[model samples]
Target: MPINKQQVRTALTHVMHPEMEKDLVTLDMIEDLIVQDSFITFTIDLPEKNSQLESHLKEKCEEAIRTYVDEGAVLDVTTAVNISKFRDREDGRGEEQAFPGQGHRKKKKRQKDEGEEELLSGVKNVIAVASGKGGVGKSTVAVNLACGLARTGAKVGLLDTDIYGPSIPTMMDTHERPNITTQKKLIPLKKYGIRFLSMGLLVDPDQAMIWRGPMVTSAVKQFMEEVEWGELDYLVLDLPPGTGDIQLTLVQTVPLTGAVIVSTPQTVALDDARKGVAMFKKVNVPVLGLVENMAYFIPEDRPGKKYHIFGKHGARDLAERIGANFLGEIPLEQAVRESGDAGKPIVLEEGLESRSAQAFVELSNNVIQQLAIRNQSKDPTEKIDIKIRP
Candidate 1:
């Protein structure tokens, strides 16, 4: 039997908006429902913008249509959220009569954001060291950057937000867990003149975090809210790769000074690096700059020979195209990895004034200069608003 619009509507009747607790048909959310042969197209007009809800609703609606209407039916279900729907109210109607949390989410979010700001009021700057994808030495860069800043007389704190695959504990070298204060706050572990924390410390060394998005985000939230990060000039956050739940959580949790994007000088890494820059730009976070790690091979025996290992200047070109500052390049040196394994940042390795350590020193200087420029020109960056997709 050929499917009709009535069957499609009937199928959607089984699809209830989770937040609204009403069927699509009853809520009048299904719009422009059309059926042509086995081809079906419709629009879901949500009461508010909730991307997680949008994806969930779309999946359920597609399943309902396939199971109830026609198993072989082709779907072209699209979704939209009209902000005006929440704004435009009748002369005598309440927001609850319109949509739950439609009008009040922003206000509540703003208040929570303010409280978060107060929680970290002692910290002067929150710098997030990140990348578009993993495995480009982001953690190494973060460790060295934090150490480098601390070397310059700036009080520094390093928070490893890579919940699933945290390496900060190994890199920073101390397996000691943070101490809980009498006031119910966590005192971060201190090493090499900087305080640090990581998920690795709170769990068994071989234990895996088989957690969902909500669980990971909840852990990050706890880190943000419950840590006693006392007065500090710089707090460097080592973020997990690819902008996801934790990245969104950070933006919503605190006022970020800016982000430092780490990448290799290759098309593959630069591709994701571009997205990293765009992510910061989208969330209104100033991109401090881009750092090219493993830019070339520098053999210990040869003091002054440059090997274009991952192609030359790919990240720098990307920075140019995207109008982001090219912070500095870190040459590949064996001691960099050796230092990391020994639980010490390469920049802090005494008497080893190699090109790699010097690169990090210069990178740290560039970051400070960029921070000065960003602060002088623009106002302090606020916590991102609720409109962005998490």
Candidate 2:
């Protein structure tokens, strides 16, 4: 029996657009699907070129179709972008003309103070890592989570938007300042297979950024618009501590796929984390989940002993109360801090599987799984409700 078109579409539905977090069929990404006998061919309409998602989608689609149809079926995949979406205004004869706002009598002058465009170029999904207040190890969690994702064969990028205290460069063991290309594009530093950009790279270590809100906004806008991230599967943004101007600017500027709020297992931290969740919800950015860092401290001498040094399950309780997903927790380990100081993230330490490291790995994997499930679900607004306690 010949393979059917409906069957091919069904298989394709299982495939997702990695960045959009939506099924290809629902997003109208699958184009030109043709099936004859056991041979099938299709085209995926990607938003841009050099997309890493193409290979992931192609591999998954082929595997899915082979399960239902003939095992030796051939699948051809091609990638192209829909350019007509960006076309300029058209006049009566379809020729480009001055927009309605600009009069035909005079050419519109370019404003000298025009703001930079909000283009998260080359990033498939932008995930912001935020906290309610400082001293919560928010940047630490962000750096390791990004590294963990990259270690799992996903192309990841880390943007340290903590203009006040950017720690990604130190935590990721990268110190070189980014160099601008002749085209005036900023190049991010690469470490452990993950590209990173930070304001820390631009200024002296001892210097403090004393700029006002507008200045900070401009600098952050430059970081987002000018950096060449180069086709990242996940761009993890380490937002500055607290919900301030920088956080507001980022949420308003970028089309964030979702956000992950990091908080320690303490009443103080949870109070702030609750506010963080409210902020993202108010802005309509999906909250992927909550990660409780330093949930507990495990003694090295007594492997079986666990200490609730920072109180217990504060974040988990908050997640439950707010009806949010509690992703997982990371125990307090000296190795986590030591690795950060040494500029080698715990996830990248060779063959060292401490409890904390394993927790991070598990947490990273769980995050991916949740995202995949959310992507496959029928309703886009449905939340993934996961409860965790310790």
Candidate 3:
């Protein structure tokens, strides 16, 4: 027996939209369905820009097809927004309104309200430091930002949520295992006026984390729910590169005050940074701003001059194009690299003369300014309750 389009469609019938409560096939969300031999690829037209919803559906569809149609089926699933359908609905002439107004919106509101049962209850604000990709010093920016916030006398906590490649321990230079409280909550390690936790601290340094999406999701949730982060003004999360299960799980787990994107002054890096900003927008998370790392370079001997090492203002141009705020630029310097390697971020490295160090100060201030404005102007972000099971 060979697989066919009918079988593929039938298998997908078992896949339901978490919020919609209807089979994808019945909702007619699937399109561009192509089947040949054991290969399958299709597009799922989604209602909005939801990375979590998209990731959840893609994973489930993969499982459903593999179980029902072919154990060896290589399925390629992608999601798209049915813009034409939405346009028709908005114009009041569409035959099918998959997501109608008022009632549908109320249903979503109820879902978000139900998720108000909180995590990180004592933390005043949560900031996620993310990027479009790696090798652009995302973790480095996160470490310094948290340190910078601490420098302002704000109680801060830095969480290294990059589970696969936890860098907070190495960067913060504290490798002692977190002590488990009598109640079993892990106490975060203290350093640089900030409490911090990372998978690096909990596991052997040489060990590799061989995990699937579901397991990673569970561990990330535990990092927030099972940790003792008492009475902090801010908790900065250093997110792993790209949008994946962990990022999706974070939004579902807590109400993030805002997010800060880090990128270098390079075309490839800024392109990924755009996707990062897009992912946050889809999830309804506010992108506080973009920080251009390695914006320029200055040789120690050439204290009177500057050089555009990567490219000039690539990240800044990206921020302007996307209409998001550009926080500031961080110059590449030996001090920044040396400071990170020694587990001390350059932001705390004494000397206002260090341009890289001073850049972090200015970036932190810009973040504070934007945060104050956002808090005053917007409602408290609601914790999202996704109906999908990890």
Best by TM-score: 3
The residue-level lDDT of candidate 3 at 284 comes to 83
Model 3 TM-score relative to the real fold = 0.69
The candidate scoring highest on lDDT is 3
lDDT of 2 by residue, 1-390 (tens): 767888888877887766678788887767656565566766665545555666777787788778866688977666554332113212233323211111111111122135633266345467789999797888888888898887655667898877788888889778887766444667677677677988888855344466666666667766787876655567888988888755765676665667899999888888889889988888777788999998998788998989989989989888999999998898899999999999988977777478778888887887776565554441222222222111
True lDDT of residue 210, candidate 3: 68
Candidate 3 achieves a global lDDT of 0.79
Candidate 2, residue 122: Cα displacement in angstroms equals: 2.1
Q: By TM-score, rank the candidates, best first.
A: 3, 1, 2
RMSD of each: 22.1, 16.1, 20.8
Off by over 4 Å in 3: 1-117, 204-208, 387-390
> How would you encode candidate 1's per-residue C-alpha lDDT over 1-390 as one tens digit per residue?
778789899989999877778898987777546566787766676656688988998999999998998888888776755443334443435333232212222233355654455546666678899998899999999999999887665667899988767899999889887766545777777677687999777754344356655566666767777887765667899988887765766666667888999999988899898888887887888999999999989666775877989989888888898888999999888889999999978898676488789999999889988887776677677764443234
Would you estimate the TM-scores of all the predictions? 0.68, 0.66, 0.69
Ranking by lDDT: 3, 1, 2
* lDDT per model vs. reference: 0.78, 0.72, 0.79
Residue lDDT tens for model 3, 1-390: 767889999999999988779999998888656666676767776656688998999999999998999999977677765454446566887543222111222233445556573577666678899998897999999999998876665667899988778888889898899766545777677777677999767654344366666666667777788887865667899887887666766665667878999999888888889988888888888889999999998788877888998999899998999999999999988888888889988899777668888999999888878877776566666777654464
